[model samples]
Target: MTDDDPDRDIRCQDALQAAYRELVSAAIMAGWSEREVVLAIGELADKHLLSLETNDNADALIALLRRMT
Candidate 1:
């Protein structure tokens, strides 16, 4: 499939979700609390966001994070 194929986006999203679930499950099995796992994900997101240049997408991400609280 070409990069422009919309189906690719959906497939990628599905794959990402599966990987996320597996990682979270592994972390929990490793004795990390649910809250710890969530906090760790938030920290990772924060670090990635800091590297992004300011733009509407960044603003939207920040807003979404705020809404989660």
Candidate 2:
């Protein structure tokens, strides 16, 4: 962890960054334009944010997203 990270969450940040990078890389590899990738990610973020204040399990979100396809 860097000294600037007072909360010592560098590892978590690293993992999240890796996930984002992989998602973008995969999207581009699969022929999704940059705009399409951003739109898809925005859709996912919207769905995720919608459940943030609900009494819902994260696994249920996974199932819901899977069903979306």
Candidate 3:
């Protein structure tokens, strides 16, 4: 990963909650239900090793998850 990559420093910042919120918002806007959005977010977060205490590599993860549906 390059230093300029936005997700590069997410692991160093406590941005997981914000990232999760954004993911949920996007999913809802994309017509997914609350349960579907939550499941998708959780799966994506776990797949990417994201946690509340971790900097979130959420940008790419969110993008990838969105394509699943």
Candidate 4:
């Protein structure tokens, strides 16, 4: 198990960046325009901010999204 090391946050940020790169590559391959991806990511950020403001479970946000679809 990884301890609460000093560099933990940096490591996590690096991992997230790698994952984001992979996802963006796949999305481009799937014909998503850069603008669309940016807009969608902004929308996701907005939803997460709303969740934080309401002190709600992020899973509830996912459920709400499923309902919208």
Q: Model 2, 1-69: lDDT tens per residue? A: 676877668667777998888898899999999889989998998888887745367778888999999
Q: What is the Cα-based TM-score of model 3?
A: 0.41
Measured by TM-score, the strongest candidate is 4
lDDT of 4: 0.83
Q: Which stretches of candidate 1 lie over 4 Å from their true place?
A: 1-12, 54-69
Residue by residue across 1-69, what tens digits does model 4's lDDT show? 277788988888787997887877788889999778878877998999997877667668988999999
Better of 3 and 4 by TM-score: 4
Model 4: clashing residue pairs? Answer: none
Per-residue CA lDDT of model 3 for 1-69, tens digit only, reads 578888767765565667767878988999999899888767886867756435456666887899997
Q: Which lDDT values do the candidates have, in the order given? A: 0.87, 0.84, 0.76, 0.83
**For model 1, how does the per-residue alpha-carbon lDDT over 1-69 read when each residue is reduced to its tens digit?**
799997998988787998888888899999999889989988998978766756667899999999999
Error of 3 at 54 (Å): 21
Candidates sorted on lDDT, descending: 1, 2, 4, 3
Candidate 2: give the clashing pairs. none
Clashes (backbone N, CA, C under 3 Å), per candidate, total: 0, 0, 2, 0
User: Which parts of model 2 are misplaced by more than 4 Å?
Assistant: 1-14, 56-69
Question: Measured by C-alpha RMSD in angstroms, how accurate is candidate 3?
Answer: 14.0
Model 4, runs deviating above 4 Å? 1-12, 56-69
